[model samples]
Target: MIVLALCLVDEARCWAAGESVRSVVDENALEGTPAALWDVDGAGDPTIQGFATDISINRGETVRFKVTTDASAFRVEIYRVGYYRGAGARKVADIGEAETFAVRQPECLKQAETGLVDCGNWQVSASWDVPARSRSGVYVARIIRSDTSGASHIMFVVRDDDGGSGILLQTSDTTWQAYNDYGGNSLYEGEPAGRAYKVSYNRPLIVRGSEYRRTSFWANEYPMIRWLEANGYDVSYLSGVDTARRGHLIRRHKLFVSSGHDEYWSGDQRDNVEAARDAGVNLAFFSGNSVFWKTRWEPSIDASGREYRTLVCYKETHAGEKIDPSPLATGTWRDPRFSPPNDSARPENALKGTIYVANCCRFDAVTVSADQAKARFWRNTGLDTLSRSQSVLVGLRTVGFEWDSDLDNGSRPAGLVRLSSTRLDVEAALRDFGSNYGSDTVTHNVTLFRHKSGSLVFAAGTTLWGWALDATHDDPDKQSAPTDLRLQQATVNLLADMSLFPASPNGALVVTQAPPDTVPPVASIRSPRTLEDHMFHLPVSVSGSATDQGGVPAGIEVSVDGGANWHPANGVSDWSYTFTPDRRSFVSILARAVDDSGNLQPVPTSVTIKVSGFARLIYAGLVGLVLGCGALLLAFVARRRRLLAKRRMMGL
Candidate 1:
């Protein structure tokens, strides 16, 4: 019986220990070796997986990526993320089968069914067809296990180190067709009228079907990417940033860019991006109506067994809809009801400029103030429109509007601009004006909702892509001509002066030490001053009624007791230190002055005072007065008694 029990116990322990299993396949092992690579261990049977990794190349440059999987039926899918002013994510082109000549066998192919399998490596090579006007930024590529259930992703960002030029792009995971349209598969009640008819609605319209399907694409025609590559820029492509990773992603880039109508943002994503900007990160809004609606993502499987990552905008249905009401209407999430409200006055719309209007051919240019010295003209781009209108105006200026003196009355310029004019000289004028008004132009409008750290933010107002448009200056397919050369120069000049892009000084430490007696010095007493009775005020003042060489009052500092201690006399405007002594035996006062450069005065001014006890003297005086009064009373009584005795003796 004991022997039988020992055998059973040994068997149970073996079962409990479990087996060491390897699931992931290795690609390097197949190099230069002849082995059948197959089978990835998992819950059930082994399946093959395929993936596409995106890479950016110059017009003639070539790039490659590697993929290895064990399952069968492996294939890759490649597409592009299209661009439009108000359009959401739209798909274009299927590049999976397009690069037939670019594919090469893995270094080695092997098949194994045992412990671990080494799948042969695969490579993809391709060159970019540089468009004349691509903006430099991130591009994406995704690799998936065709027969399995896993994916790998890659990215590229275009850079121009020579000129210190680069573009930043912010991409979100999900795009919603309409507010609360969670499924995204269904069309809104009145929408789906086609592109041409949709444009007639004067707002963002919804679209449906696979043609409008919103998904990840890395190998499509990205105008900005093409434009950058064609112009010889090095680009880097990053994956879309969701709320969970936005903060980390934004810090890695100098500029934060958003394009193709980024209307929805999760609260955290919005806060992170805003925080990044506050920390001196530049922002370029290449898309329209951004951050107008807050959205939430719902990750779940749909009826088709495919994973659906849906974004929903329910601002109107939110609990504090009235208190924290959204700018958009209740049912329609299309309208951008940006906070602080955008003025609808003519010639001033925050999102103003000629790009949208001219492309759509809806608005006309209007004349604004003309100043020859300031380079004024009526035919300039949206930027020109902003300058001309604000120059003659006496009040607040409205962005993206035709300057109308009658409408604005005399107010500050709005945050966004939609200039009706487009003249080279006018553009120059706006650039010149922008130098002085850059911070005021963008921040003043949204001051209440600023990030804690000081972030450099600029609203392009126009979607010309600024420097990116310069690459396509000579291209026939260019939409708007490169911003006028002179105007571009003016922009450079303004950027150099603006706080966002301050010019570096020649020397590191121009003013190492404070100048002599340049400003009044401030002082205070650090040690406690004692008084006979606690009846003294502390002494604090500016040292020396000192005057700056420029005739300005030199600031000063004061301390009690001949410079024994010091404190800052921040509030006192005069040059004197006075304090009531505390109820202690001894005390001292001192004062000194420090200039802006932190240079202390050669000598400190101080005063000391000795207090004697006066309370005992007051008590002695009271006693003396009482004794004199008593003596006087006794003398009067004695005189009266003598008179009475004398009168009685005389009468007898």
Candidate 2:
């Protein structure tokens, strides 16, 4: 920031002096740049320094750390972040005084193939085998220099088990790497910005660029983790990459959570999530615009000779028309302009029940709907408080920067309940972009949907949710505004409800019984399929209620032409559709019900209505009567000649 400010100052001075510096600026501009340009953490003399031996370690594997300090003696302490009364970090190890060693900071340079500025290939000074007792979460190595005023830390993950019944905290490390301006070349820097197509974990994250000055973890991820842990919820931590790598890992876990700003994703990651949800894993997209990208990873050794260390995405304009063909296009999952031609588009809405529809609207108050107040989602939350709280969780500052909602696509899941929404006046700039985006008015909805597998997926639908939950990290810049108890209570109640489905003794996840889907649904035509001119009304409606054991059915569809075609029959309580007859004499329609469990009701109800319109109707009625009599006689004869008639009926 200082460099940018200073450079702007120079540009003004040059213009005032009538000097055209841009066209003639020499390489001196490069040599004269301050060394802070390459300083990983801006502390003039980095107080303490370190790197984890591995990104992830199995429960029994050895965990190592390479720590160093050029001159000062530092105290190295290790803390495990988990459910320790949610105090944030539990001190697990004190490696005491560690002798210092020098870490050679490599000069920043943009890679030709991948734009990341690679840094740090130093040697080790410490190593620790992951103790068998350590739980799953990010472990931070806090190195405090005895001679300095503050400390700096580096961390890694200890992935032990699938964390059944425990929440899986997915760290957005991929986004962190994208924004890591270490060595001056993150994907966020360079001319026109975002010029880098890829970034490497080989480099340290920039200080203060992201909230809490700790990449995506300290400000965004840690606060939520701390709150859950402090509240005594069993939470485990892993990166989104882990989800992509081990698609079925969440099978044993009841709920999976994504931290703030988790924008990037691999195609496999998207598949895994959808598969998990279908198999009964509850999901909480506690953030916004998730699973919008289709990406693939290839292994490559960093200069450190370290295997498995970089993030790659040939996204957006970066993925040109002539790129090689690969199943993973490394492009936007839903955008036609960015998705490769002839590729199947898998939009985020299919899994999330929503997607990033518009952006750049300032925060708006999040108001709950009356429907939400009456819905089962408010369980454990006091109704008096929820109703008397003015229906507003937070003011205009509660939602903004980005928003998501259930798009009006054909794939919105069945059995969804909307609880709240914020109406946003969009930025004209995005509107002028002239894409499907940039709507004049976009509403962000916070919703919950019960999957057929008997698990619920809740979407907070805003990027600002994490901010409200993170009061402990009082970093002024990251602090939530006009903070109140309602937002916190809502989250607390949500987690409490989620904890009900605990893991069984053998580590199997408990499945909830779908109350509204206990019994099969029954379908019926509430009104005549056809209307007579003398009828009380031209009734055209399909109606049904769930079977005896269940509540209202989730869906119903009506089919005409003996099931040749079908259309969704949506209604408030039961499926209903109204259609005025087009003067046809007779019409045949069938209705079927679908419970929350996606159980299609048997014995589809059918009805045929005869309209009283004359002339054309009489002629059609006469033709239908003749055909009906002929068909009945033919059926009887065919029944007598079974073998030949069966082949004909089978269309042989």
Top candidate, metric lDDT? 2
Using TM-score as the measure, the top candidate is 2
Off by over 4 Å in 2: 1-50, 66-73, 82-86, 96-100, 108-110, 162-165, 191-194, 210-215, 303-307, 317-327, 336-343, 380-397, 428-439, 468-470, 474-479, 482-652
Tens digit of per-residue lDDT, candidate 2, span 1-652: 3443343345333334543222101201212222122112432235355556456676557666655565345666666654333345545455655443434434434566556554435556556665554457787766666666346666678775634535777777777666666555555565223456566666544444443243356655666665555444556666677788866778778788886667778777777888888888888888775675555665434445454466666565344442424544666666555454566666666677667766644666676643345343443344435543356445345565566766545556654545576666676312311133544777787766667776777777766676665554434344356544456566654554555332211112123322444455687665653442332235555455433234445456666556665555654234466555555456667777654334555567788766555565567779999999999999988887998878899999
Per-model CA lDDT versus the true structure = 0.31, 0.57
Clashes of each: 104, 3
**Residue 54, candidate 2: alpha-carbon lDDT:** 59
- Candidate 1: which stretches are off by over 4 Å? 1-167, 172-221, 226-240, 302-308, 315-454, 462-652
Query: Which run of 10 residues does model 1 get worst, by summed lDDT?
Result: 194-203
Task: Please give the distance, in angstroms, between residue 130's alpha carbon in candidate 1 and its true position after superposition.
Answer: 21
Worst 10 residues of 2 by lDDT: 21-30
RMSD of candidate 2 to true structure, Å = 18.0
Model 1: per-residue Cα lDDT over 1-652, one tens digit each:
3432332234223223542210111101111111112111111121222222222333222334443345333333322222211121111112342442323334332112111111113443332333222223343333344445454333333322222233345542233233212112222222222110000101111221123322112111133433333322222334333333435556655656554434445545666765666676655554433444444333322222211233334333232232223442321122233322441221222221111111111111222332211221111223333442253321111122111111121221221122122221122122110111111112111110012233323333322233232332112122333223332332232222222231221121121111222333344433334332232343322233443232222234454444544433432224454455544444555555543222345556444545434454456668888898988999999999999999999995
Q: Give the TM-score of candidate 2.
A: 0.69
| Cα misplacement distance, residue 554 of candidate 1 (Å) | 32
Give the per-residue Cα lDDT of candidate 2 at 347.
68
